[model samples]
Target: MSAAFDYHLVLQSASKLDHALELVWSDGKTSTFHYLWLRDNCPTTLHPDTKERTFDLLSVSADIEPLSFSVDNDRLMIEWSEGDHHSQFSGEWLREHAYAGDLRPANKPRARSWDAQFLKDMGSASFNDLTTDDAALYSWMKQLDQDGIILVKDMPATEQALDDVAHRIDYQRQTNFGVTFEVRSEPNPINLAYTALALPLHTDLPNQETPPGYQFLHCLANDTQGGESVFADGLRVLEDMREQAPEHFELLATVAIPFRFHDETHDIQHHHPMINLDHQGNIVELKYNAHIASVFDLPEAVMHDYYLAYRDLMGRMRQAKYRMQYRLKAGEMVVFDNRRVLHGRTEFEPTGHRHLRGCYVDRTEFQSRLRVLARQHD
Candidate 1:
């Protein structure tokens, strides 16, 4: 059989339970669709143009069940118990989205942790291809989403290059610094990034309620004596900590620390653990900025231990094994997940000129564009 015909799902049988409908596929796989779920996702429940959900769950009874259900080759027909309504779900759709056994909807790309070795085979793309081709853009986004960092080369040494690539994904995320920021030695600078000083590996704006996501830094010039860019996968370091030092990892993930960024005009403050984890204990974010990290106000009993944990993680990040040190060339732009990739710089000579322009795109926007491109490719 042809691939498309062979891949098509044909319902072998469908049995209605009290509150759910069970389906048996031709390939012997099964799926259980809850009545409420089926009702909420009915074709009629969504706007034809916008595809937004219009059905309200509260409008139906909680105990609603299917009155009758039947299989028609590749589709499942259902007569709901409420409102004399019916729902038709294609067997192909039901199978692809089956929420039974090992069948589940596809999840967003997961982080692929990396270390110094990543630099040897770093993910990179050409700027011209990304801006001109959808396939190239999708491939680049996938790599970026997986690796949390990438390099885009062949860019013009101009601010427009950075802005064009950023808008290709979505609108730029504006912070207090503005929609875009400059990175060069400046007198009376408000941020250390604007001064000629060595920066520690840290995330930007950990003080904000939601820090900027993906950061794109375009190197306009790099004629300075030093100023090599340094980056480390925060997730990689944390993963090792989880295995080698579980207690220290627990402390960092559990203890919330205060972070503040203030000037004459603005004061932004928020409390987040150095290592933020999901409910399943997966490391989702790392917020470590020694410059802006407020004084620890933990209980006197745990203060000593917290410092030890914090110091251990910071020391690991500085180690050469976890860091990728490179001198970015002009016309090269580096993109990184600001939340998961710790970035820093070596101090440069104030006499020599080094310039870089940067902007941000929220992770949501990046993921949304990726998803749309993925659908088109699929």
Candidate 2:
């Protein structure tokens, strides 16, 4: 049965307009369907084999009219006066495409933020279970979307194992750092992660033209002291700033900052607001990186205000109420949304081998995998 045939979603009565059908749904809400839309979307016009719209709209006259209309149990049936054509539209279908000014569909998942206390355990999965079980993988992807992070234990402790898991979701996003880079203490480090330093909470690769949306880090060995993983929701912090200090939130939301990554081979630079907003003024991206940030080129007065907002945001990120810290174990991997949440590590002693393999995948591919898996499992 079509979704429109649901008895609960039926329309009580329809008032046919000169150019549209004014519908009063059983639930009290109302909507209108244009005369042209009904003529073009009749079920009889749909190909029987393909069930796709086969009617040619150009064949219909611009001043089309319906000879008569009637409310059936399942649909609003229409008879065109221009021709012996017919149309039947379900009430559910009309509600789905109602032009009621909603920004997005009701079914799409909205990103919700959480602090440390809000989490139980990091969404955990065994490598073996996720690799073979489609249902398990679907759950993992949902967890990733909701939490923006997941931890998988019991990996095979091999390079191929990490690659296998990554490809199952998406392809490798190779950069100057190569397909996959090793994160061990180096004498001459090109990046801060290459050394045993307490990296601050920040987004990854903020200097890229389009920074990596999601990052994966697999702990191969971890016998050193410190180096606990840190996670924080930058958008949640921005929400706090909006309520606590509107001025600070406004400055950060509108001010663009420069981030750069320079090396012998690659010189990547990008300018983005610390808090990015969409047309609806919703936080779409939280691009921040103290490590890669370049000097502000704004006027002295503007820079002063920028720093004040910047420092306050930085301080809020460090607050215990916003952070979630967990130690990574060997054969354990963590995945996170690099654009939404900030990730970092505490300084370790550089004693023993503390190796971590890392890689990146475009968010588009990640979302594609999730949707595919969801359909398959459903």
Candidate 3:
């Protein structure tokens, strides 16, 4: 047997500095080529990183000049005057750069900073000074969409005010943990007696098949001594995990874990990868609720390893470096992206009173409101 191949030059064009080449097949099909791609992917002393695949052409400046090109028999070569370099393209090179697959869709745009319409909708003062107004509320929602959290101050210290806040955000009062759930210090022998419940840092409704995306808690009364609400940005924790324990991060991103909520009233369970990623595999959300984790059904050999990774992740969650704590005063409400932020509370004295009306809102609704408000400016 013999290794066999056929070669021919189909089309060729050149510029003063850059060139274009096209190759045709026996069936008369054509494929275009750019000299810049060849130069960038050149396997020579000038281009040491052969493995570097550059797909994002948007990053290149418009001022870049094209390189000159030529075809000799089966090989396509490019010559650039900038560095006085030459690159030869092989059949493998053309195949590697060929557009044989579907192009991926563009990434969803994320604002690096709040826009003018967003600020106007949120009210200018609210964006700059956190002032309250109809526009300010709109801006607050935009901020929440961008940062996954927003604080509204000077809200009315009444149940009606809490409901008003919920209504403004278009949040339906979730019945399971409805619009207003009293958070008074209760006596429970099994947990603690006559003391505030030190709620663990976790997202609400982890057991639900479709967990709520946003949570808003308005402080109506806070004459209590302690019970400060702690907020941890789950995305920040994920970044820390990437830097400190990459393997653990990989495990969380790849392994699906079971979460459950079972009681006399309801029994719910679901499985999700601990680190959720967008279509591009970019870290988007982290769901870690040990209390609700029903089981870690890993292979017997890796069971111990899984537990160790879980423990390490929990330790990182507890670190002060990853958490931000602030106590809400009367008439203030804090809303956060429940899917990407963990909330907890410190224990307070039962003698004093602490009350908050909490509610959940779908994140899509919040984002929809923002998009609508953004369009109003246009």
Candidate 4:
């Protein structure tokens, strides 16, 4: 049923002004709906099956006004002066979409930043629970959204085990590296992740137009001497930068820098700001990889300042207070938002065995699954 028939909102009174409808709702909330807006949004304007708007603005007069309107059966009914058309909108729908005042939040959980201590207190879900229980899966995903990372333990010691968890959320993101990538020390590797050298704290694939979002690294084996995984919350680091060095934050968020990756077959390059902010000025993503960062081709006037800002952020991200280090054991998997979490690994003996199977799932898929889970549970 439409809100027009099922909703319980009661319109206290409705009056016709020169060009708008002034409505006083039962809860003492007042709203003004313009004449053109009301005519354009008539219930008859929408197709019954698709619910898509079929009304054309050109069909109505530019100075169109309602000849008369009334409140009946908890609905605001209006008769248009032009074409003798009529419209009836539910009080519930109008109040839900009111634009006269501050709107309610979307009800999504806000991200929480963490430090080194988070490793000890962080939550984890067993692979069995995640696969078997819908509530368990939803809770794990909720925590992932909150902290941008989580550890999944007690997984089966098999290659396909990682795929099972990834598919539960959505499809894996394919890149030049293929559907999934293997992390190990390989000879003449095209990426530094294939080497035993110490990898710096960085987000993966800043060079791509649309970089991968969440990353899942399943530790199939880890018997190396010293290959402790390191992670730093990029959101935490930048949040501090915004407060302590506002100038640096401004430059990094405004300037676009080049990132490039080249191999025998593929050469991917893109330019993006180091820090991306939403319209509300909240940090949404971070793209910082020193290895893949191309030469600074900025104007000389801003180039020196940009480097100073870059170094400041780099230094802050490397600080011990912001980073958490942990060595993964067999049958353990770590999933993190690649766009918000900076990850690295320490140097280890190449002779020893240390292998991890990994894959990527974009942010959109992760959020979509979460919303669906929420709907199911609700």
Top-lDDT structure, candidate number: 4
Ordered by lDDT, highest first, the candidates read 4, 1, 2, 3
Enumerate residue pairs that collide in model 2.
none
Q: How do the residues 1-378 of candidate 1 rate in per-residue lDDT, one tens digit apiece? A: 223324755788889766788887787767788888888888789889999998888898998887888898788888878888888987766766676643554444388999998887778889999999999999989889889999999998777999999999999999999999998764345664556678889999999988999999999888877899999999999999999999999999888889999999999999878888776567888888999998778988889999999989978998999999889999899999999999999887666667889999999999999999988874
Each candidate's lDDT (Cα)? Answer: 0.86, 0.80, 0.65, 0.87
Per-model TM against the reference: 0.89, 0.82, 0.64, 0.87
Residue ranges of candidate 4 with Cα displaced over 4 Å: 1-23, 31-54, 61-64, 72-74, 81-83, 102-109, 186-194
By the TM-score metric, which is better: model 2 or model 4?
A: 4
Query: How well is each residue in 189-224 modelled by candidate 2, as lDDT tens digits?
Result: 556555666889999888877788778899998887
Q: Model 1's lDDT to the true fold? A: 0.86
Per-model root-mean-square deviation over C-alphas? 3.4, 4.3, 15.0, 3.9
Query: What TM value does model 3 have?
Result: 0.64
lDDT (10s digit) by residue, model 4, range 179-205: 889987643446545566888999999
* Span of 10 residues, lowest total lDDT, candidate 4: 100-109
Q: What is the lDDT of residue 140 in candidate 3?
A: 66
Q: Which ten residues in a row have the lowest lDDT in candidate 1?
A: 1-10
Ranked candidates (TM-score, high to low): 1, 4, 2, 3
Off by over 4 Å in 2: 1-7, 16-21, 33-70, 77-88, 101-109, 186-194, 278-281, 298-303
